[model samples]
Target: MNITTLSILQQEYPKLMEDGIIQSNVPLKEHCSFQIGGPAEVFCTPYTQNQLLDLLRFCLNHKTPYFILGKGSNLLISDKGLSGIVISTERFTELTVEQEYITASCGVTLKDLCNYACENGLSGLEFASGIPGSVGGAVFMNAGAYNYEIKDVLHSSVCILPTWESINSLSPILYLKVEEHNFSYRHSVLQDKELIHLSSVFHLKRDNSETIKRRMDEYQQKRQQKQPLELPSAGSVFRRPEGFYTGRLIEDCGLKGFRIGDAAISEKHCGFIVNLGSATAKDVLQLIQHIQEVVYEHYNVKLQTEIRFLGEM
Candidate 1:
């Protein structure tokens, strides 16, 4: 951003500065699972709903671009760096359980949510036990595993609809029921609309604690056995194409173990692209492009990435 805008933010949002909740020129590599990314011009982590609203209002009023960051498990940030502010909801970690329902903030990790459910003898979230992402990120992508998705258990969500009028009026908050979200395979209404997820309520079933634990353990074991868990990766690189399993198709194309720079298609799991130490964002991008080209040439099916790419490529 320009100096004028920066000065305006620093002057107007003094609480953020005083609390050290906002920082300048923060590196993003450490925050994401891939361990790759350049710096963010500005980074802010709001601790409460009011603080979050203030931050959003300031950005909207100033017409400054901002991106919401979750666990960063399914993200690829450009090496050139992001130009505007990055709002991380890591501080919004509140979680509560009441009867068969569990409410979790956007920052709560999927693992933590699953563990909490298991501890409370709630089933349904066992399938997400091994997914590496925050609750908001999962809900944003309608994250799924083993044929179970977030939509299956989602009851409702609290969101901020950053529509043009809402941003101008500073009236962004919205409470949406499950049907309103329009969840589908690797997608949700949030993907298309200018909606920011705040928290989610999941409706589950009462189950034996031991049974929940057993199911969670089984899923984790399966993930470890099948995925390249030992290395740094952004999980599955591509969405499943219709009538074709992504991994099997890549393996059939002999793309497994293929490398560009330090990024490689995982031999253990062909669907994944692993950061084999010192991998750059460029390396991963090139590898992905190469995979798409070769896979299309051989199998005649185009692959779409499941992970989100931020900043300029």
Candidate 2:
């Protein structure tokens, strides 16, 4: 079940901790760009799929709750801390290029992937260059900007599917075709299934490195100008509602720069809620709730959070 406790893991995998793959009482703020989470009771980083599979099996069997941590860009963990083990995919960074295809492991950053593609004279991922997320997180969310999404260039993916019955073969390893992803705006099949993405293949067309770099630089410049890059935030707090821009709505509601303790709506960008030194999860939650209430009352639009919250508020 992987959702009960983690004592057995610590006892059985003592060597893993000694090898630096497992840790205890790890502060999650250090891992995420938001710098707002408390601590994780247990934390693990497995370098290979085999190791990950073994850990997964153990967790599933032992009913120890575990949360996957990828990039940590879009999360708002609890100030009270999380009780379960956190499995970080940061070390799963194997990347390769073969002709028009680029294969990257789960932990590969979008920036590195884009740069690698550019270096190889490949194009199509330039729009993802400035995104602060890992490949797995990006794919899981079908993350996109500038009218391009991961679904556009995704060729295939390797993942693990957990089901009670036979899933084509005895092995859990699956090669998911792009057509089977069921992708939509900011969502992928992974969000609806108990699947773990291991790696992916992206198809890109040939292009001049200079041209690709220029496009990438243009996008990065836009992000720096429009977003609150100087502040600690979990990117945009709300998903853009149809026919309405979230940031604009918040700004129109006179809620920009609103504060709840150390958590405040970014003065530069209304969509973001930034942590202004020693902000707690409680503060962010209160701020988010206030924003939602105020926006709904003013514009009849219920702001839905894009950021994933974990643990107790």
| Candidate with the greatest TM-score versus the true structure | 1
**Model 1: runs farther than 4 Å from truth?**
1-5, 168-171
lDDT for each candidate structure? 0.91, 0.88
State each model's C-alpha RMSD to the native: 1.3, 2.5
lDDT of 1 by residue, 1-313 (tens): 3466567888998887777788777889888999889988888888887777778888887788999999999999998778778999898898999999999999999999999998999999999989999999999999999999999999999999875567556567889999999999999998989688999999999999999999999999999999999999999999999999999999999888999999999999999999999999999999999999999999899999999899888
List residue ranges in candidate 2 displaced over 4 A. 1-7, 163-170
Model 1 TM-score, 2 decimals: 0.97
Model 1 pairs in collision: none
> Using Cα atoms with residue i matched to residue i, what is each candidate's TM-score against the true structure?
0.97, 0.95
